[model samples]
Target: MSAAHRPGLRVNAALIIPESELSWRFSRSSGPGGQGVNTADSRVELVWDVANSAILPTLQRERLFERLGGRLVDGVLTIAASEHRAQLRNRDAARERLATLVADALRPPAPPRRATKVSRGAKERRLTAKKQRTDVKRLRRPPTD
Candidate 1:
């Protein structure tokens, strides 16, 4: 958290990442723009250093670090969006993706699974099946004493 508690690039009311923490790269989009594609950079790549970001609270930082570690490269998460023909749209897409990714990563972990025991009827059925298989095998063998 910054000393002045300023917020930027609002993902939601609860999660506001500062603009200074985000960086962007723009390039020519590869599809569907026709004449505009030659001159405009419609592809947007938004990069955020998630591991070292001060915007995240301690618990959220830990959750993001643990859950999204595999998706991050050198602790930086990059989201690229080029589906839209306009640069602004692509930029918004990237931002939305980043927000979604971060929000999902920061979600709380599921509760631990409780141990379960087999019911009496289930155990009896399993034993019955094993006995039937054993009896069939025994019956198939030679009857010589």
Candidate 2:
């Protein structure tokens, strides 16, 4: 498939990818569906170079790297889709999936959570409960002389 078709359906307008940036390969699909599966090269694999992307900022690239981790090899982000029986459909699906992934990566995440200490009242309640449990267990034991 060509980049123009994929570009028109991109989720993020800010992400303008060059035609050469995307690489796609088609393979025969696997799974149920008998004859159709054997004849169709419906499996689509779309790979994008995240480290060298012209559209993404440095921060966005870092975030994507952190989120995708081991799944991203070198600098490339790979997406595969084969749910459809047609190569074109699978190709579109793969591109759509990549768009969503990139859009998600662009969004800023909530700041890291600050560590919090237990409130004094809560600590007191816990201690009180522990003392009550100790008293109950002591009562259960036979009375010591």
Candidate 3:
């Protein structure tokens, strides 16, 4: 982030990443820009180095890296936005995406589920239903001579 930009990005109330750590690049977007599409650099690519982040807590940083390992390339994560026609909107979109990805990756994994046996009452109900079906089928057959 340059002196031109005052406010930094706010990922959450607890976590804030300084704009200085963020890198932005703009390119001619392949998306809608009417006749100006070829000339306008509306596409925004936001890159952040998670490995060297200063704001992230140690535990959360490890969890984020572990969870986002496949997405990160050489400890850097890049998000590109071209959905909007304006460069500012695309930049915002990219930053929002980055925040969401970081927040999701930092979350703890859900606990594993343990295998459970069928309850005794449920087993008994199943057997009773089978017995009723057998009785009904037997009644449906003609009397044996």
Candidate 4:
């Protein structure tokens, strides 16, 4: 994703993050990619401080914490991208991931399910099946007489 194509995310009614809230750091990536990966800083680390962000609302903050609490540390939201060979592409990918995370956090959770009781007909059917199995077992046994 290009800088021009970056989405405008509104955390609050007045505050909006238009590619500004994101901070990217490029570092030499480990693992495969031959010599290119060893020489170039292809790993992109994207950091967004959710706790100090003025854009997000209280509800959004709470939701973000609940959804991304594992990735978050010291009030900062961190995401890394190193799949691509190019640093810019990796950086863009990381930013996209962060945007996706935030979008998911903004959504409301489903309502809690209510406790349900089994129907009487269903219970009767279960008992009937058990009795039929018991009768079959009794028939298989020898008479006491």
| Candidate 4 backbone collisions, by pair | none
User: How many steric overlaps are in each model, in order?
Assistant: 0, 0, 0, 0
In model 1, where do residues sit more than 4 Å from their true spots? 1-7, 116-145
lDDT of 3 by residue, 1-145 (tens): 5324746677777788888899998999895568888988998999999889888888987887899999889888899999999888888789889989888876678999999999999999999999999999999999999
Top-TM-score structure, candidate number: 3
Candidate 4, residue 1: lDDT: 45
The whole-model C-alpha lDDT of candidate 1 against the native structure comes to 0.84
Off by over 4 Å in 3: 1-6, 130-145
Better of 3 and 4 by TM-score: 3
RMSD per candidate (Å) reads 6.0, 3.6, 3.4, 3.5
Per-model TM-score, in order, reads 0.70, 0.71, 0.80, 0.77
Q: Give the alpha-carbon lDDT of every model.
A: 0.84, 0.82, 0.86, 0.81
lDDT of 4 by residue, 8-115 (tens): 554444446666777778899988899998799999998888988877779888988888889889889888999989888897688668767777777789899999
Provide the lDDT at 4 for model 2: 61
- Arrange candidates, best TM-score first: 3, 4, 2, 1
